[model samples]
Target: MWQNEPPVAGDLPAEQGIPTLITWNHGGNVVAVEGSWDSWTSRKMLQRSGKDHSILLVLPSGIYHYKFIVDGVQRYIPSRSSFCS
Candidate 1:
């Protein structure tokens, strides 16, 4: 359930960016996400909830590539199955 249409005026503040939720279900004691959004320089840590780890990112509309660092190892998602919109 996601909407591509532009938000109506007043729906959100002009300074706010899109709210994107990133989730990882694979097991790990520590999980983090690094993406092109920050040039892969900032590793944002995800909060663990039950069996999953997730982080909410507020980003501008654009394309980005990301990888998950689970317990100090990097994991990549193949481009063929990646979501781009």
Candidate 2:
């Protein structure tokens, strides 16, 4: 949820999956290597939390990707030009 924040406590259900789940970072900032973040506290907590349940806050590598067409040719334009001003 946040980079420099503590776990949020609430009455959430761990049913089907981890009690409390957090998707990508608040701003989709990939923090670490592939599975390298596996050692982080969030992963650890997911491990210790219980069985049939898990939690992980992975830091994915940053990337700028998008599908577009340029010069009459199809292209995978990852740049911000697609959303230009």
Q: Pick the candidate with the highest lDDT.
A: 1
Cα distance off (Å), candidate 1, residue 79: 6.7
Residue pairs in clash, model 1:
none
Q: Give the per-residue lDDT of model 2 (tens digit) for 1-85.
A: 6587655655454434223232222121122112222332221222222222234432343331222222233333233322211
Residue 19 CA error for candidate 2 (Å)? 16
lDDT of 2: 0.28
TM-scores, each model vs. reference: 0.74, 0.18
The window of 10 residues in a row where model 1 has the poorest summed lDDT is 76-85
Local accuracy of candidate 1 as per-residue lDDT tens digits, 4-85: 9998888876765678888888799899989888787899999999989999999877777888999999986564223443
Candidate 2 lDDT at 24 equals: 22
lDDT, model 1: 0.83
Residue 71 error, candidate 2, Å = 58
lDDT of 1 at 74: 92
